[model samples]
Every structure is written in C-alpha cells, then in structure tokens.
Target chain A: MTRLLGWILRYGIAALFVVAAVFPLAWMAVAGFKAKTEVVATPFQFFPEVWRWDNYTQLLADESFLRSLGVTFAGAVLFAALSLTVNALGAYAFARLDFAFKRILWVVVITTMFIPGIAIMLTSFVVVTQLGMLDTLAVLVIPGAASGMQVFFLRQYYLGVPVALEEAAQLDGAGPWRIFTRIFVPLSKGAFVVVGATSFLAFWNAYVWPVLTITDPELFQVQQYLATFRSDRASEMGLLMAGSTLAALPVIVLFLIFQRQIIAGVRITGLK
Target chain B: MAVTTLRAPARDTRSRGRPAGRGRRRETKAALIMLAPLLILLGIFVIWPLLHAVYISFYTWSFYEAPVFVGLENYLTVLTDQEFVDSVVRGLAFTAMVVPAQVAVAFLFANLVKSVSRKTAAVLKVTIYIPAVISEVIAAIVFSLIYAYRGGILNWFLGLLGREDTAWLGETSTALPAVAVPAIWIGMGVASLIMLAGLLDIPEAYYECASLDGAGPWTKMFKITLPLMKNIILFLLVTGFAASLQFLVLPLIMTQGGPVDSTTLPNLFIFRHFTNDLYIGYSIAAALLLFAVLGAVSALIFRLVRSEKAVDG
Candidate 1:
C-alpha cells in the first residue's frame, strides 16, 4: 500500500504538469488545422472535423506578417550572434586573464546584473533618439549587445574550464586571443550553444522593447506584426492559431534539439 | 569561490614568466581589447541612459515641448496621481500572489520529478519547461481564446456541466486573476526547472538517512530539503518577484490593461503614461521610483545574505 501510494504521488503530479504544459501547444497546433467554426464551437471539439491546411497558406498570404517574420528571424539571428560574441569575449577576460582592476571590474559586472533595464527605458529611448537609431535594426540588436547577465553566466561556465589547458597553450607560445578562438571556444561548445540558442529564443520572442523602439512597418518584428494582426482580426481564431503555430515552431524545434544541454547547463551554473 | 580559483593559477603562470611586468602589461592589453566592445556598448546603451534619466526626472518635458527645469515637480505629480499610485499597488499585489504560487508549485513539481525514474525525469523536466520556451505573445493569444466569452473554451467546458457562459476577461474582478493564471502557467516551467537544479544539488544519502529515521516524504522534505535549499529558495523568491513586477506582455496583449484598468501593472502604467500622455519627464520620474524600490530591496537582501557568508569580489 505504501509503495502504491508513493507511485501514485510521483506519477500523478508529473502527468498533471505534462498535460498543462503540452495542452495549449498541442491545441494551437491542432487548431491551426481546424475550420473557423470548429475552433470556436461551443463544446470545444477535441479534434478538427476537417483538417484545413489552407489556414497556414492563408496566413502566409499576408504581406505584413511574412515581412515581419523574415525581419524578426534575421534580427534574432543577428542579436544572438552579436550578444554571444561580445559577452563571450568579456567572460573570457574575467575568467581566464589577470589584469589591473580585474576584481573591481568583476564587481562592476556583478553589481549591474540586477539593475532592471525597463527602469531606465525612458532615458534609454532618449539616448537612442539622440543617436538616430530609432526604427533601425541596429537599435534593436545593439542595445542588448553587452548584457551583464550573459557575461555573468558565461563567466561561471568559463571558471570551470581547466586552467591547465590555457597554461599548456601559453607554454607553446599561444597568445590570449589565439588560445581563446582555437582552444577555449571549441572546448566550451556546450556552454556556447546553451547561451546562443537561449538568447536567440529570447530575441525572437521579444515584444515590449521592439514595440517601444521600432515604428516602421518594414522593420516591425514578429511579435509586433502578430499583435497588429491580432487586434485587426480578433475574431479569426483559426487564422490567429495558424499564425501563432507557425511562429512558435522554430523556437520549439530549436529548444527540443538543445533540451538536455540547456537543462544541464542551468544545473551546473545554478544561476539565472 | 570562482574569483580565487580562476585567478590563482593565472598568477602562478605569470610568476614563471620571463618578465613579470611585461607579462602583466600584455595581459592588461589583451583584457582591455576584449572588454572594450562590451564596455562601450553598455556605457552608451545602459549606464548613460540611467544617469540621464536621473537628470530628466527633475525637469518638465513633454514630447513636443522643450525641457523646463522644475525640481521635484514630476515626482510630486506622480505621487499625487491616483491612477499611477494604484498601478504600483496593483503591481505589488500581483507580485505577492505570483511569487509564492510559483515558488510553491515549483518546489512540489521538482520533488515529484525527482521521485520518478531517470528516463521519466528527463522527459518530465523537458515537457514541463516547454511552455517557458513558448513566447509570451502566443501564450497570451491562446489564453485569450480560452477566456473569451461567447464560444470560448472555458465557457464550453462549463456548459458541458450544465453551467452558463461567464465572461472571464470581460469582468473587472476576474480580469487580474484571469491574467494571473497564464502568467503562473508560463512562469511555473522556469521556476520548477530552477527548483529542480536546487533539488538535484542535495545528496541522496541525506534523504536515505531521514527515511531510516522513520521520516516520510513530507517529513523528509521539511526537515532535510527545505534547509539545504534555502539559498536557492531565496534566489527564486527575489528573481520571481522582479519578473512578476515587470510583467507587461500578457496584460498588454490580452486585456490592454482594460475592464476599468483593473490589470494595469507598474510597467504598463509607466509605459501608457508616456505613450498616452507623452510626458517624458513624468515617465522618467515614475521609472526612477521603481528603480529605487527594487534597488533598496536588493541591497537589503544582499546584506542579509552577506551576514551569513560573504560573496567575494
């Protein structure tokens, strides 16, 4: 009886959480194939009576959404690469190299990690306007280029890397940059992917910052355009689901591929 | 711990160098080269803006108008504005509800995931974290449909049990809690993952000993797990509070802070004041107020934690 109780206790909560997590995602995917009537039906049809593949085709037909999708994809890719490169270099300095003010610099980086960006957003907007970056992709990607949180996480990973390897490289006459690019970076692939892929997902899903900065229809991102489309076609659950399903796929697929590494990295680092 | 371990070996390498001063200079040069990009970017984008906002808070500058210095007027205006005050209160209320629910559910889920087989644990962990990977936009949209009045999923399920359709997001009283559900759902995934990391850090030998002493799972959790995971729990509480306080996406997309502004959060309130009113200084003032509060709380927590074991610089 005790064994049975333990089994039930463990599996019951696991099953409940799985259903809760997967339900909306599964519903979104399934409902994208649904007819407009079936999606909003009173009884909440468990399955679509007729699979409407055209729901996707119709959504793709929208010029603005397609443009926004392309823009957001390119922007996220760039943002991820930009932040990863800049932050990794900084992390390497903090983790591997000794220099004047090293401790002070680490303190500075750690201190700024907790400062919320939105609290200074109004003035940041002013600064962006002064630099004439408004409505440009540069504004979207550049502001987040040197995020302290990224540097902090990367530094934690770099600390665990064997210093003996860098010393061996030093004995062989490899400079910091050469050793970093050729040896340190390649060996730290797990950390890099976790940082890069997660940052990519974050940039792709970014809503408020883009909304505040970008106004050009040409440069409007996925979240911005989808929001516009949402307000415009509020009652069109079928189209909205189709759009959301399509928008959500790349990230979900990416997350699945990197699932183990991401979870393992978080556990090892033990920091957000 | 990381600082000392990372630096000690590098210093040893330097002492074995041909010339100590030159090696030191070279390292400094390399450090500067590598750190320049990040420093320049952060200075222009983050630090400078923060200081400038402090300067702007004392002035009066609507978007179209030139700035006129009026010391403390903007702060006074925000303090006296009932709507702004209410928004701050609402944001705190949301955080109070969200932080605990997230922390508790995360603690429970993490323990349950640990009890399962290795394969099941991995699968369960991934599945639970999947929602967090989904964007807030999609989450809001999906939840909105479920909460919609006519032909909505919630009402549909209710009607199957012979109940009438009720407006979920359409009513003021229900709107905040309605929005809170999605926030919690999306939030739990990350919270549980973080909690799992903490849980995994504890040794199985400790639990085995507890069980040998006649402790059940609940007793083991309270006696052994809770105390060991104190740091993790505290970290989760602080970070969770910050995230919940800054939540704007769900309410922005779902209700637009509507149904009589019942769901207007601090971030949304400041954003709408600037966007709707176009008063830049006032917005800056409101933002500074939030920054000060968060900073003070963080400093207090740091002090409390430091009194236990100091964080090395």
Candidate 2:
C-alpha cells in the first residue's frame, strides 16, 4: 500500500506540473480562436465554440498591429546581427588576443551586468532623446548592441577553441583577424546561433524600454502595441488574445528550433 | 605537442621578422579595434548613464526646462515619501515570496523529472520550459485571464468545486500574491533546468553508495544531493531575487499597481514618478536606492556562499 501510494504521489505531482505549465497557453490559444461573446460567456468556455478564424484576420488587418510586427521584425534582425558581430569580435579579443587592460576592462563590463536596467532608465532615455534617437528604430537597436553577458558567454566558447589551429594559421602567414575569421568563426557557429537567437528573442519581446522611449504608435514594438490593447480595449478579449498569440508566435517558433542550444547555453553560464 | 613544435618555428620567424615591441603594438591595436564598438556602446549606454543617474538624482527636472540643481532634496523626498517606502516594502515582500517558492518548486520538479524515463523526462523538461520562452507581458495577460473575476478560469474551476469566486487581481490583499504567481511560474523552468544540470553533474556512485548504506530516497537526497547543489541554488537565488526586485511588466499590465498600491514594486514606483508625476530626479533617486539595496543583498549572498565554501574546503 505504501509503495503504491508513493508511486501515485510522484506521478501525480508530475502531472499537476505539466498541466500547470502548459494549460494556460493552450487555453489562451483556444481563446484566440474564440468569438468575443463566447469568451465572456457566463460559464467560461474551455475551448472556443466555433473556432473563429476571423480574430486573426481582423488583427492582421489592423494597421497598428502590422506596423508593430514590421517594426519588431526589422529591429530584432538588425539588433541581433549587430550585437552578434560586436560581441563576437569583443569575445575573440578577450579570449585569444593579448591586450592592455584586458582583465580590468572585462571586470568592469561584467559588473554592469548586475545593475538593473531600471536604475539607468532615466539617464538612458535622456541620452537617447538628446541624441535624437528616441522614437526611432535606432533606439531599439543601438543601445543594446553590446551585451556584456553575450560577450562573456561567447568568450567562454572561444576559449575552448584549439590554440593550435591559430598557430597553424600563423605559420601560413595569417594574421589575428584572418585566424579569427577562418578558424574561430566557423568553429563557434553554435555559440553564435545561441547568442544571436537569445538576443533576437530579447529584442522582440522587449517591453519596458520601448514603451518608455517610443511615444509614436507607428514606432511601437509588439509588446508595447499589445499593451495598448489591454489599456484601450480591455473588453475585447478575442482581439487581445489574438494579438498576444501573434506577438508571441515568432519567439515560440525560434524557441522550438533552438531549444537545445538555448538550454545548454543557460546551463554552461549558470554553472560557471 | 606536435602543434607546439610547429608553433616554435613560426614564433621564431615572426619574432625575427618583427621587433617584439612592434608585434605587441600591433596586437594591442587589433584588440583595441575589436573592442572599440563594445566599449563605446557600454560607455555611452551603461557607464555614463550610471554616473549621470547619480548626478541627476540630486537635481529637480521634468525633461522640459533645464534641470535645476537641488542637492540632496530629491533623495530626501524619495527617502521620506510614504509611498516610496511602501513600494520598497512590497518589493521586498515580493522577492521574499518569489525566490524561495521558485527555487523550491524548481528543485522539486527537477528531482521528479529526473526519476522518470528518459523520453518522458525530455518531454516534461520542454513542457515546463515553454513558459520561460514567452514574454513577461504575454504571461501577465494570460494570468489576467486566469484571474479574471467574471469569466476567469480559476473562478470557473472554483465554481465546479462549489466555492465563491474571488477577484484575485482586484483585491488589495490578494493582488500582490496574484502577481507573484505568474512570476514564480515563469521563472520555474530556467531554475529547474539549472538544477537538473547540477543534479546530473553529481556522480552516480554517490547515490549507489547511499543505497548500499541502507539510505532511503529522502536520506540520499538530503545528504548527497542538496549539499552538492549548493552553488546552483545560490545562483538561482541571487538571480531570482534581483529579477523579482525589478518586477514591473506583469504587475503593470495585470493590476497597474492597483486596488490600493498593493502591487506597486520599486520599478513601478520609479516609472510612475517619471511618467505620471514628471519627477525625474525623484524617480532616478528611488531607482538608485533600489540598485544599492540589490547590490548589497547580492554581495551578502556571495559572501555567504564563499564562507560556506571555506568551511567545506
């Protein structure tokens, strides 16, 4: 009896966890396919009554939603590409090159990782405004182009590269840049993908900075655009749910593709 | 060793061709070129703003007129304000609630998943981790539906159980806890993944030895597992606490720090001062104070971990 009880207890908890983790999202997806009246019906509908496809169509037809989607896609691609290049170069230098103040510079960068972004919000905004970057895509792409954590992770990956490869390149009269491009870059594709995907997801889902910086609706990112649905049209559950689902679709797709790399990256950094 | 032999001749030729000082200068120049973009961005976006935040904390400004210097007044105002004090208390309360709940649940789930079959474990891991991939804004919106008083799923379940439905997000008493639920849920997946990695790192021999010594699962876990996973737990704790202190998006979207300022975190408080009241200096001052508190707490946790390591060593 005790053995049976323990088995039940163990799997029971696991079942509860799985349900809790996934049910809300599934329910939200269902609600996105729900009609307006069916969503707020007296007895909450577990699934949509008719599976209305018009919710998505209507959301897609909205200019603000389309604009936000375009802005988010463009900004994420630019931010990810720029940050990957910058972080990779910096990581390579830290990992393989000998330079003055290298250790001190790295420590300084790492220390800023702990300072919460809210603490610097006012000054960052002021600087952006002063530079006339506010309400522009540059506001989203430039400031976050050099993440300390990304550089640190990529440096860790680069350190694991065989030094003998670079040595061989040197024998062929290759310079540091050549060895970096020819050897390290190709070998560290996994690290680059991990960092790039993670950075893109962060930029795409960014809420606080974009909300504070961008006042014009045309320039709003997806999360900020979704927030307007909440504040302005709280009664429109179907529209809101559809918008939320659409906003989340890109990252969800990316996560499915890059889940292993993302998890391994987190583990390596966490363990360190 | 063969590569080292090859590198010796290359090193010799390079040194013979170029003076050591010139080589060093070239290496430094290349490194500087590579590092310039990162350094410049960090200087302008991170380091400068940090210093500028401290400077602006002492001045009164609203982003329109020139910032008038009012040394220490904004700090005094922030320090003395009852609402600011309440926000800090709420923030601490949220962190205190979330960090332990998240870490404990994560540890539990990690262990449970580890006991399962390999394929089942993989599926469970992905299912649990899916939430972490979703944005905080969407997570908040999903839970707002769950907590909705009229047609909420939670209330719907309550109705099935013949219980009265409560306004989870609308009540002052329940609002903070309601907000914390999603925070804990969203953070669980990453923390558990870290814990799972730590668990897998432990040698199987230790558990086998424990079982040979007539140890039960509980005994083995407490004696073998938890002690070995101390560093991972500390990592989760410090990062989770720092994140909870800056909790804004969920509460802002779900409750707007509402009902009676119950869910008003420090970040939300700072945001309100800057945007609604236009007290930029005061807002910056409050944020700086929060930063100091988080830094001190993190230092304390690190010190504790270090001392534990010393004891172990």
Candidate 3:
C-alpha cells in the first residue's frame, strides 16, 4: 500500500506537470493551425477541423514579422556572444586572479545583485543615450554586458578548482593568457555552459529595455516584436499565435538540449 | 573544514620558492592585472548606476528637461498617488500568493522527481522547466487564448461540466489571480530544481536514522529535509519575492493591467508612467518606493532566518 501510494504521488505530480507545461504549448500549436472565425467561435475545439498552415504562411508573409524575426535573431545572437565573453572574462578574473581589492571587489560585485534591474534602468538608458546608442542594438547589448550574478556564480565554481593546475602551467612557462585559455577555460566547461545558457535566456527574454530602447518595428526583439504585432493587429489571432509559437521555440530547444547542465547550473547559481 | 586541506598545500608551495615573499607578491600582482577588466566594468556599470539611480530619484527630470532639484517632492508624490499605492499593495499580495504556492509545489515536485529513474527525471525536469525558459510574451499569448472567454480551451473544458462560460481576463476579480497562476507555474520548475539541489545536499545518514526510528516520509521531511534545506529555502524566498514584485510582462501583454487596473503591478505601473512623459518622475519615485519595500522585506527575511552560523556573513 505504501509503495502504491508513493507511485501515485510521483505520477500525480508528473501528470500535473504535463498538463501545465505541455497543454498550453500544444494548444498554441493547434491555435497556429486555427482559422480566424474558428479561433473566436462559441466553443473551443480541442483539435481544429481545419489545419490552417496558411497562418504560418501569412505570418511569414508579413514584412514586419519577418523584420522583427531578423532583429530578434541578430540581437539575441549578439547579446549572447557579448554577454558570454564579457562574463567569462570577468568570471575568470574573480575565479583565478587576485587583485589589489580582490575581496572588496568581489563583495562589491556581489552587492550589485541587490541592486534591482529597474533601479539602474533609467541611468542605463541615460548612459546609452549619452553614448549615442539609443534606438540601436548597441544600447541593447552594451548595458547588459556586465552580469554581476554570472560573475558571482562563476567565481564560486572556480573556487572549487585547484590552483595547482594553473601553477603547473606557469611552471611550464605558460603566460597568464595562455594559462587562462588552455587550463582555466578548458577545465571550467561546465560553468561555461551554465553561464552561456543563462545569458542566452536572459537576452532572449528581455522585454522592458528593448521596448524602451527600440521604437522601430524592424528593430524589436522577440517579446517586443510579439507585443507590437499583437497590439497592432489583434484581428489576426491565428498569425499572432503563430508568431508566439515561433518565438517560444528556441528557448524550448535550448532547455531540452541542456537540461542536465542547466539544472546543475541552477543548483549553483540559484542559491547564490 | 576543507580550508585546512587546501591551505596546507599552498603553505608547502610557498616554502619551496626562493625569495618566496616577493615572488608571492609578484604573482598576486599578476592576478590583479588579469582581474582589472572585470573590476573596471563592475565599477562603471554596477556601482555607478546604483548610486546614480538613487541620486536621480531626488530630482525632477524628463529626458528633455534638465533635472531640477525636487527635494522630497518626487517621494511625496509617489507616496500619495492612489494608483501607485494600489499597485504596490497588489504587487505585495501577488508576491505573498505566488511565493508560498511556488515553494510548496516545488518541494512536492522535487520529492516526486527524486525517486524516478535518472532518464525519467531528466525528461520530467525538461518538460517542467520549459515554461520558465519560455518568453513571457509567448506564454502570455498562449495563456490568453486558454483563458479567453468564448472559444478558449479552458472554458471549453469547463463547458463539459455544464457550466456557463466565465470570463477569465475580462473580470476584475479573476484578472490578477489569473495572471499570477502562470507566474507561479513558471516559477515552480525553477523552485523545484532549487529544492532538488538542496535535497541532494542532505546526507543519507540523517534519513536512514529517521527511518530506523520509525519516521515516515512526512516526519522525515519536516525534521530532516526542511531544516537542512533552510538556506536554500531562504534564498528562494528572497529571489522569488524579487521576481514576483518585478513581474510586468504577463500583465502588460495579456491584461494590459486592465479590468479597472486590477492587475496593474507596480513594475507595469512604473513602466506605463515612464512611457507617458507627463508622469515620468512620479514613476521613478514609485519605483524607488518599491525598491525600498523589497529591500526591507529581504532584510527582514535575512534577519528572521539567519542561523548562528550565518551571522558571520
């Protein structure tokens, strides 16, 4: 009886998760294939009698949607690479290197985690404006370059790494950069993957800053893009759903591929 | 405990070097050099903006106008504003609702997932975590359709129970809670994963002893699991509160903080105010107010929950 109850408990929660996670995604997929009138019809149809693939076709046909997709793609890719590179370098420093204000600097960096994103948003906007980066991808990427949380997470994991590995490299006449590149970087691949996944997700889901910074429909990222398109053309529910489905696809793909590493990263980073 | 083991080798390495003191100093300086870029970046971006934001909160400025010294006016205005006050209250309530629900569900899910096969657990976690990674806009749109009155999937399912279609987003009563459900859903996967980590950290000896003493899973969880996971739980409480307080996208994209602004969270309230030039300073003031509330709550939690061991930090 106890064993049976345990099985039920596990399966029950699993079923709830399936319903919560999969159903909406499935409904969105079905909605993407839905017709205009059928979408707003009196009763919801679990499966649409007609699979309107034209919804995707029509959505793809839109110059704005296509442009926004291009904007989102370019912005996300750039944002990920820049954030990942900057964070990695910063993390390396905090992890391996000792500076004049090493303890103080790490404390200060970690302290920034307490600074709410909205608090600094106005100044960041001002900074971007002064740098003449307003309404551009530079504004999007540059302000978001320094992730304090990433630095702290990376530094914590790096603390677990043995110093002798790098010392051994130094003994073999490896320079600082070479030691970092060959030894530190290769050894911290797990941390790197976690940080990369986080940066990707952060940049991809960014909405407020993008909405404020970019006004041109052509330059909007995915969330902003969807909001603009939906608000402008609510009549095309089918097309909007299609656009939303596409917007959701990449992150889902990433989550599926990096589930274990990402979960491990969450274990480290979440507590921190 | 691990510190002694780590330091002993470093001490030995120090003794083997000629002119060890100067050599160590030189290496330390080299480490500082490699660390320069990060230090500079943090100073300029994190520290500077933080202080600047507080400074700006005291001034009256639109992007067009030079900021005028407003003294306490901005703060007073934000305090007195009806909409701002309401939104802050609503935000707090939302956090109160979402945090506990998320923590509980996450714990339950983590417990369930632990016993499953590794492959099954991976599949389950990936499935669950998909919502967390999904962009708020897409999820909002999807949920909007699900909660839509006429032809929405949820109401369609409800119709099978012979109940009339009820408006999920259309009604003021259901609007805020409607928005919060998804917030909790997105949060659950992350929370569960965090709890699972904490659960994994617990030594098997405690559980084994508890079971030998005739403790069931319930007692074991309360006595063994909960106490051991306290730090992780506290961390979740702080982070979860922050995330819930700052939630804007769902309400913004889905409800537009509508049905009489019943769902207008503080973040969305601030965002809307900033977007409209007439009330920009007021929005900043409200935002600062929110910052204070969150900071206070966090400090309170830290104070209340801190163990004797945590006092050093």
Q: What local lDDT score does residue A167 receive in model 1, on the 0 to 100 scale?
A: 76
In model 1, how large is the Cα lDDT of residue A191? 76
Per residue, candidate 3 scores C-alpha lDDT tens digits across B12-68 of: 222222225655576576666665666666666667776777787788877777888
TM-score on alpha carbons, each prediction:
0.93, 0.93, 0.90
* CAPRI level of candidate 1: medium
- Candidate 1 vs candidate 2: which has greater lDDT? 2
Candidates 1 onward: DockQ, in order? 0.52, 0.49, 0.45
Ranking by TM-score: 1, 2, 3
Q: Choose 1 or 2, whichever is better by DockQ.
A: 1
Please list the residue runs of candidate 3 whose C-alpha ends up more than 4 Å from where it truly belongs after superposition: A61-63, B1-44, B296-313
lDDT of 3 by residue, A121-172 (tens): 7776767777788788787776777777677666556556666676777778
Query: Residue by residue across B230-285, what tens digits does model 2's lDDT show?
Result: 87888788879888888889999999999889998988988887778665888888
Query: Best to worst by DockQ, what's the order?
Result: 1, 2, 3
- Of 1 and 3, the candidate ahead on DockQ is 1
Native-to-model Cα distance after best TM-score fit, residue B149 in candidate 3, in Å: 1.3
Which predicted model would earn the best lDDT? 2
Question: If ranked by lDDT, best first, what sequence of candidates would result?
Answer: 2, 1, 3
What value does the lDDT take at residue A198 in candidate 1?
78
Shift in Å, residue B291, candidate 2: 0.4
Write down the lDDT that model 3 would get. Answer: 0.75
Please provide, for model 1 over A199-238, each residue's C-alpha lDDT reduced to its tens digit, 9 standing for 90 to 100.
8888889998899899999999888877887998776778
